[model samples]
Target: MAEMRLIKKGAEAELYLTDWMGLKAVLKRRIKKGYRNPDLDSYVRGSRTSNEAKLLSEARRLGVPTPVVYSVDKRNCEIVMSYIDAPPLKRFVDGMDPEGLALTFSRVGEMVGRLHRGGIVHGDLTTSNIIPYSGLLYLIDFGLGEHSSDIESRGVDIHLMRRALESSHHEVSSEAYLSFIEGYRGVMGDLSDPVLRRVDAIRRRGRYVDVNHRKEA
Candidate 1:
């Protein structure tokens, strides 16, 4: 095992880029929390690492282009996966032209739709979690993922992406957002009415209007 350089640090896990078994790989290690009791903390970490691996396997089985899992150490509360050598979608779209932006959004939507259709919901669907390489879009980070056949879960996934775009990429927010939906709907034909309603609610809430004024007396 070579020195693991920190690639990403998050609330639940820290990602490191290192050589595993003589191949380049990503190592996601659960961080220890001092606030919680030792026993409970260990259990939570173990469970999370296991769940992430299971979800990734499920997504990959359904043909989602995620990193392939190489190994897992439940005791260490860590997982090793293939490293994707591509810029995150956030960086990729930062300099994209109109056509490139549209293509990127469409592809993101399609991938999400496929995952939802296969009964998976990526709890976090931000551009930062996606990579654009070789004209292919790959979704990463299953830490918050769950299996859900519910349309609302799927809608929330898309809604999160829209919100992320609004806050992060303000310039092309309108057009890029529309392209994302086009691809999502193209796959999840006639999405449940409830899902659309929830998406509308997400939009309304995103306006950041006074919550008290919005509620009917």
Candidate 2:
């Protein structure tokens, strides 16, 4: 095995770019936590790695662009997957003009809708998790994704994306989000209502709303 170069380190995992079995791949290795019980920590890491790998393949099958898993080592709490060469959306979204930015966000929303329709909820939905590839948007980083048919989970997914946009690209956030909802509705059809209503309910709960969201323009 060629030495895997560390690309990022996160709370749960470390990302490495490597050549696995002569194939270029991104390896996600769950970080070991010393504070937790050994047995519990291993179980948590292994399960999350397995879950993320499963969700990555499943989401791709549902026509949601995501990396292809090459192999997994449960003992090591690592997953080797195809690497995407595109930059995350957060790096580019702001450079686009209003119309262009909204158009891109609409595609992001549609992808999320497609995932939801397939019974998956991306627990972490943010600009940083999206990539532009082959003239389309690809969703990445399924560390927080799971299989869920619940409306609340689905609402929370979209909610997170909207909040991400608001904070990351404040200028085009609202307009882009409206476009996102349009694309989501287009794919969700009749099912969009319940989830959207749940999103409003979540906002009303007050936990997701910060002073910035409450302030008038």
Candidate 3:
């Protein structure tokens, strides 16, 4: 095992920064849960780890900006992958001018459109999962991602971001998302309007709506 520096520990996994084969890498090791049945625990960890790797590869194949997957080790329930040196978008998006913000969010929307065009839904599309690397934004953390072409699934994914932005980046969230929609439309063509309509319908069915809209209503 390479010398690892602990980066973060979440409920399901522990992230470590390490050097792999002379290249910098991130090792996401799924933590075993003691409360669950031993066999079930192993199965869950193995499947999620494998699925995450698959999702990353699929996204890359679909031309989405995602990390390079190095290898998967089911025995250790770990994934060793390229280290993205850039900061997450939550930290990166701060204090930018409105024009720069709109451009960046538009690019973000295009990335989402690319993913959806391939019938994939990034189960978690939070700012934390988006990183900027060498002037391009890359999506990371596919642990919650899934392959789905359903409009509801796609709508919900977009809706989740609307919720996240409303809760976290309230200051510029509204305008940022509008920029995203514009980019989405540019990339998705005819599909954009329907998906966005579903986004609105999905929001209406939920307990919350966009914060700005709620205020105006």
Please give, for residues 1-217, the per-residue lDDT of candidate 1 as tens digits.
Answer: 7889999898878999999889899999999999999999999898878878888888888877888888889899999998998778888677899998888898787788889889999988888898877767788888778889786787788778887998999899889988988887788777734666678776666577452466666
Best by TM-score: 2
lDDT for each residue of candidate 2 in 1-217, tens digit (9 for 90 to 100): 6888999887778989999788888988998999999999998888888888899999999999888899989889989998888778898987898788878877887898899999999999988888888887888888778899899999999889878888888988889899999999989998999999888788778565543467667
Model 2 residue 113 CA deviation (Å) reads 0.9
Ranking by TM-score: 2, 3, 1
Every model's TM-score: 0.86, 0.90, 0.89
Q: Please identify which of the two predictions, 2 or 3, would achieve the higher TM-score against the true structure.
A: 2
Please write out the lDDT profile of model 3 over residues 1-217, one tens digit for every residue.
6899999897889989998899999999999999999999999898889889999999999888887889999888999999898778998566889999899899989999999999899888888889988888899888777899888888988988887788878999999899988988888899887788898888777577463565543
Q: After superposition, how far is residue 153 of candidate 2 from its true place, in Å?
A: 1.1
In angstroms, give how far residue 53 of model 2 lies from its true place.
0.7
Question: The CA-based lDDT of model 2 is what?
Answer: 0.88
